[model samples]
Target chain A: MSNDIIDGILEAIRLLFTFDRELWGIIEVSFRVSLTSTFLAALVALPIGSFIGLREFRGKKTLSNLINTFMGFPPVVMGLIIYLLLSRSGPLGSLGLLYSTSAMIFAQFFLAVPIITGTAKAAIESVDPTLKETILSLGASERQLWWELIKDSKKSIIAGFLVAFGQAISEVGAVMIVGGNIRWETRTFTTSIVLNTRMGEFGMAIALGVLLISIAFIVNYGLTRLQARGG
Target chain B: MNLLKVSNLYKEYYKEDKSSINVLSGINFSINKGECFVIIGPNGSGKTTLLRILGLLEPPTKGQILYYNEDLCNISRYKKVQYRRKFSFVRQKPIVRNTSVFNNIAYGLRVRGMKWEEYINDVNDIIKLVDLKGLEKKNARSLSGGEMQRVAIAMNFVFSPDLYLLDEVSANLDPMNVKLLDDFITKIKQDKEKTIIMSTHDPLEAIKFGDRIAVLNNGQITQLGTPNEIFTAPKDEFTALFVGYENILSGTAEMDLKSGLTIIKINNLTIVASEQVEGEVKVCIRPESIGISKNPPSNVSYRNNFKGNIEDIRDLGNTCHLIINCQSERFLATITKLSLNNLELAINSEIFINFKATDVKIL
Candidate 1:
């Protein structure tokens, strides 16, 4: 195990410097999949979160509870559900999107949306109600107030997106199941680590694991700093 | 026409457990243009809630709020925003953005889409007017409570809104800063002649600054009149006690036709009052209005002079409170301790309480 780990580190370092075409292809696909999923989730989550944060309604608690419950739903369960829907003999099977990067991206997007929306909603909702009243009393239109709330909560919203991004990029169960872990195609950093470990490429597996942890650390540190400043 | 008129306003809060509580019930008032109307009440008297409703920050549960005879509730959504811009609210706690003091004051003007040069000029003028000099670029969040309140006052005053709504803006201020706020309000009243409506719990503030004072209790207006009228002729027992703990004594009136003076008998003590009110009534006399002496004066022919035993002596700064037990009644009078010492007055010391008949008012 020790030898394999050393070898994985050396091979990962070599791959980083060589600009190997295959390595580039995998890295590009990972970025494309993760960034696209996070961006799409953010676009939908922002207004949803703002609306949930700003307004009160009859079913507001029920809606918030439902979203919070979804925040904890297992990714594997979601993957299985999607796989069944898009697999052959299933409802969307004819589209041929199962086991493709599109399928993997879709799975990650679904996993990420609730995290972004839930965290964003919490951040925006915690703003002092007096702030909202002051802005409105200054003759701010509804759209202007929405923009002001968003601006005031920019740090939290960014943190929310980063959390969603971290969640999407590090996920394996859903992406692997939906993408079929195809080489140089749908294998994200996490899926590649799993696949390389299974194939006895311990050096590459350990290297990818360390890289993922480093990325997660930097993102979280930056987020915490912003949160402290905003607070 | 009144600039703002609220009729039958009510607000209810429904809790999470679905139990409803009525916070403000059937509140009604009207303020004409350029009037410095103020409301004074104790905590939880719905002053802030009323201010919020007037500012259009929240809708009253049921009522008609009219602006220039146009029903605010009947206005279109877009027009509501248009009409709302006429008034501005300045909260007591001063919700300033985490930005420079200049920027905090400039934010309202910026949102109004004014030119940068014009906005800067207005911000400077407001800062100077509020006497916050040489601190324009300081971070607002780092400011002291008094400075923040001053900045808030300047921010709202700069806009020169048609109506200004302030909620206990002087509650946390020191005496000097309270005077600054008082002067600021007076200047606004004299210069702009803008309609100002504010809520304060301080009686002195109501007496000194308010043109007309409205007393609120249990979400309803208990009394509304000039400060002197409300202070002198409070309509109810609650208002009397609230205005000040001026001594209240129950009495029966007896008219002396020859002297044309009414004598009130509270158990055994007889007090003379100028007002010829008949039958049973309550008389209120401020402690300061009555005088105290160690011995009954030999020369003065005062209509009201009573020999009594000193029951309690309370020293408050330069003034000493002497509660005298005259027969079956207790009369509270304010006197200096110098007199207490000159008379060698102590607890249960014999003394005389004297005052003019006009000092007492039969309520």
Candidate 2:
């Protein structure tokens, strides 16, 4: 609508096509921390999620309720919690992780794990109960049975991971509070977008947003193909 | 030795209202190795519960399942799985995984730790055996109901467990699929050491597959014996009516010592039975025992003859089930299709039906 807006749009496209080093650096950090945190979260979340979903035991209801509460937990609060734990003179201060990429990873890991666990539990719960009987009737052991269940819930669990990745990659509050958004060290897509917008560098922020979305699209497109072929 | 001795098994399910409904009560039977043991009953008669308990899918609420004289009632879940490896259970509904038919059939082998090379041919052979050779690559869930049932049977059959627990596998299948499954089951039964415990509500399937038949009703086993023994000599009124191929008529009985037989009077009709049961009695006569002739069967001294008219002619493939009305009394007589053709008997055809005194059972 305005000359300045038009110029910003043109600049955003130019920055993307020219492959700006600053923009790529931000993309690299974003993917590195988010991917690492998502991967680590899945490792811990999957077993806990599957165990809670499949078994009937004492305190199952309370456990499920607690995980569900964590699923909707605010990311800023998670950041504050990790900040306090890693801050100097706090309980876990000896590691000197605060204001580092590792501190950012800790905050994001706490934020991502609960979402993945909740989705994994729900996915496992939705598998056909009769299929479990069929698996056991084949003389499958308890481990084999759970493996079959996990395989059955593969699509939903992967979808949950994608959601967790999305949340971690676009995160600002947690990484900012913990890593201080130090450029070339802890600055990721969301924190960089926040800083660039504050400085009236809207074109760069918008370009980074487009690239993040394009990456999400590519991952989903690949998984869609995989889901179709799997059937 | 008995492969399994189920002694006084019971199962109950509690509803949301906290009231318990009994599914099985004091069920008792012993199955020998290689025997085709069939538990036949009406729907809701505890057949499924009994089969599920036998397969170790569920524990009995009371009593014991002695597997080879070792009580399995209190075994650990791990131990139960070890024992389950010795058996294969084909559920009533044909439930399959959302995978290739080949994988579904190979499932048992995979769980048993058999390599793909070791089980591939066995799976292929079973696919061919169940008439699903080319469909192995097809997704199992995409198949038709009949095809699903075939895959379900092949899934269990490929591994050849020591015991087979089939719970109404042919209950809702098409005739073609049922025949294929029945043929495959017959082949399995041919192995003299592979025990099979099949449950069904179909009397024909019971007669066809059972080496020993147990008739369950109202959560209890009313009768258990060879098909012949169970059919000919059902001990109670429930069994007599359940397996009603035999025409059971309530009548007043008088011991006729002069003729060395008991006389049963039904309505205005009189029948003679070899037994000496007195007072109110049930006169049981197998349809096959009754003879149909154009003329009265003469000089058959022990025979009871009646002049009747064929009221309904039911063509049962090779055998014809004829309902004859003799002076307002009805009788079910089964004659061969060839005999019906030779006698030119149709509905309303005049005929004489005769059953010897020994053919009738006084219960």
Candidate 3:
């Protein structure tokens, strides 16, 4: 058993260092879906976040609380919702997104938007009100003021984006249920890991696991650097 | 011509628990074109609120502010922005943009649609004017409080808005920075086409800079007059103290038929005032107004004079406040440090405190 473990570790190293094609494919797919979905989510999230942060309106607190609550939603639940929506015979079935890369992206979007929005809101809200007043005093239009505020909070917003990306790329259950983990089409780092391990391809599984952790590390490191710079 | 008019302006702030604070109440004032108007008040006297309303940053709770005959208070936010661009409100503690000093100062002009080539020289000139020439590339947020304040002023000054609204810009600055700011203010004052309205808690600033001054206290305009008038004759108790009248004594008065003066009996001491009020009233005398002498200066008939023992001496930097006890009635008299040294006065020293009857303000 001990020898088997050591052999598996060595095999994992070889697979990673040799840039195994199948393993890289899994990585590319995982990152592609995560990057695209997170970028799209950011476009939708940032404005919502800033609006919620800056504007005073009825139901504002309730909306903020709902965003916060959604940040902690179970990944599998999100996957289930996307699966049901995109499944044949469901309301959104006509678009035929079920069991596809887009379906996985839809699930990931649901997972990432809340995290990004929640974090962006917190970051934007931390901005000094005096800065807003000063901007306004400079005769900034409303859009100009919001733009300045977002620029003021760019570092934290970027940190939040990185965190959301980390969460999206590491997510497995949602992508699995929605994408059906197709070999060449929808398989990702995490889904590939589960499949490779279950099928006794320990090297591929461990390689994907290592790459996943490296990505997570890079994201957290960026966050740490941002914080250290007092951003 | 009147450039701006604030009519019966009112502002209220509601708290989380539903309690509200009336920040400004029935504030009425107007600024003549090319005039320097100063609002003098202690901290939290609604100076900022009133300035904000005038800046078009806030709408008065129940009033109208007309800018060149246009009611700014009731105008839409878009319209207010258009009008607000005509003015810049420099805050007490300037919150600078998180950028370079040059960028911060250039922000106003940039927003005004000036291209970089059009505004760089102007920005550089202001940076030089503010004595922040070499620090143009430095991050404004990283600067000291004084430097950030200069940035705030420079940004506004460079924009050359039709009106400049400064909210206690010099209150917390060091002497060096204060001089720099004062020089900038004087420079701005040189431009006759630009009107400026500034607020300060310092009476001296009001006296030095204001063509006219308004005293605000507890959400109301206590008095409005030229600085000389506000200082020499504060209208009410609040205005009196606010204008640096340290000695406030409540007493009853009657027309003294023989002296032909209203004599206020404060704690068994008869103090004569020029005002003809003949009932309970408060007598306010600026400490500086009370002349202190080592001995009773000759013609005692013309002045209200009292021989007192110095109870305590408060050596406040440039001037000294002597708490004098005259026949058990305490009076505060301020004298220059030079006099304090020259007279060789100390605690328990015997001295005479005197002021003319006209110097006593009856409130």
Highest-scoring model, TM-score:
3
Candidates by TM-score, descending order: 3, 2, 1
lDDT per residue for candidate 2 within B1-363, as digits (tens), equals 888998988999999999999999998889889899999899999988888888888888999999888898888889888988998999989688889999999999999999999988898888888888789899999999888988998898888899999999888888898879878887887899899999998876777677788999989999998775676456787886787675656679998878788889998889988888887655668899999889877787646899999888877699978888888877888889999999998889999998889998764
Q: Least accurate stretch of 10 residues (summed lDDT) in model 1 chain B? A: B226-235
In candidate 3, list every pair of residues with a backbone clash.
none
Which candidate model has the greater TM-score, 1 or 2?
Answer: 2
Clashing pairs in 1: A8-A203, A8-A204
lDDT of 3 by residue, A87-172 (tens): 89889999999988899888888888998899889987899888888999998888888899899989989988998899999998
Strongest candidate by DockQ: 2
DockQ of candidate 3 relative to the true structure: 0.54
- Judged by DockQ cut-offs, is candidate 3 incorrect, acceptable, medium or high? medium
- Which of the two candidates, 1 or 2, achieves a greater DockQ against the reference? 2
lDDT of all predictions? 0.81, 0.86, 0.86
Model 1 misplaced regions, further than 4 Å: A1-21, A80-99, B73-77, B191-193, B245-363
Q: DockQ of all candidates, in order?
A: 0.39, 0.63, 0.54
Report the TM-score measured on chain A for model 2: 0.93
